[model samples]
Target: MSKYLLNKFLFTVDRDPELVERYRAEPRATVEWWESARANRILGCHADESSTWLCFEDAEREALAAHDYPRLFELGAHPFLTLTLFIAMFERDHPPLGFQTEYARRLAHVRLPYPDIAT
Candidate 1:
């Protein structure tokens, strides 16, 4: 389920540059954007509110920084989406300090075969 959510986010952002811009400009607006996408059938993901809107929070950064994949994944964060969030953070000139390291840490921990991750 979480994997699918992450895929949806990636897909949405890949196709919608404005959404990425919005994410870069307003990180907190992610939930609103996701809701709009789901409502409009733009996001081809399940419409469950429980584990879908976990992208707007500072703890997300801390979780990644600490390599606490369980906490992040349990909170509905797809590993790839976490990477995408990092990219958006940087691309929008809002790079989180040590975000690259955190991303590398997560990538190193990835043991599954996800298309987004080269590993």
Candidate 2:
């Protein structure tokens, strides 16, 4: 079982179904979705190099850097923590930090796209 309460990725985003719709509308969405878990992506493809990335759930940086263990209690340091932090950062003014991929065969150098849609 997970140590922290993960706000289910799919359900949380499902509150806005357009996200999935937009993903489908996109030219390509390279993901190995775990359908059993409501399309939770097990492995995501890096848009740049097609590198495979493990998916993390509900992890964050400030929640960690502050040594805020209590808040981080919910953000487990699993191999997949990289992807989870992205969710916790949703709608935040700043982009995600403290996320890293461990075993991507083809690592890609991705930069933050300006004019964030969430803003």
How high is each candidate's TM-score?
A: 0.44, 0.18
Q: lDDT of candidate 1 vs native?
A: 0.51
Model 2, backbone clash pairs (residues 3+ apart or across chains), number: 6
Task: List runs of model 2 lying over 4 Å from the truth.
Answer: 1-7, 26-119
Candidate 2 lDDT over 2-64, as tens digits, reads: 222233333333344564444334312312232223333333433344324333332443433
Which model scores highest in lDDT?
Answer: 1
Clashing pairs in 1: none
Instruction: Supply the TM-score for candidate 2.
Output: 0.18
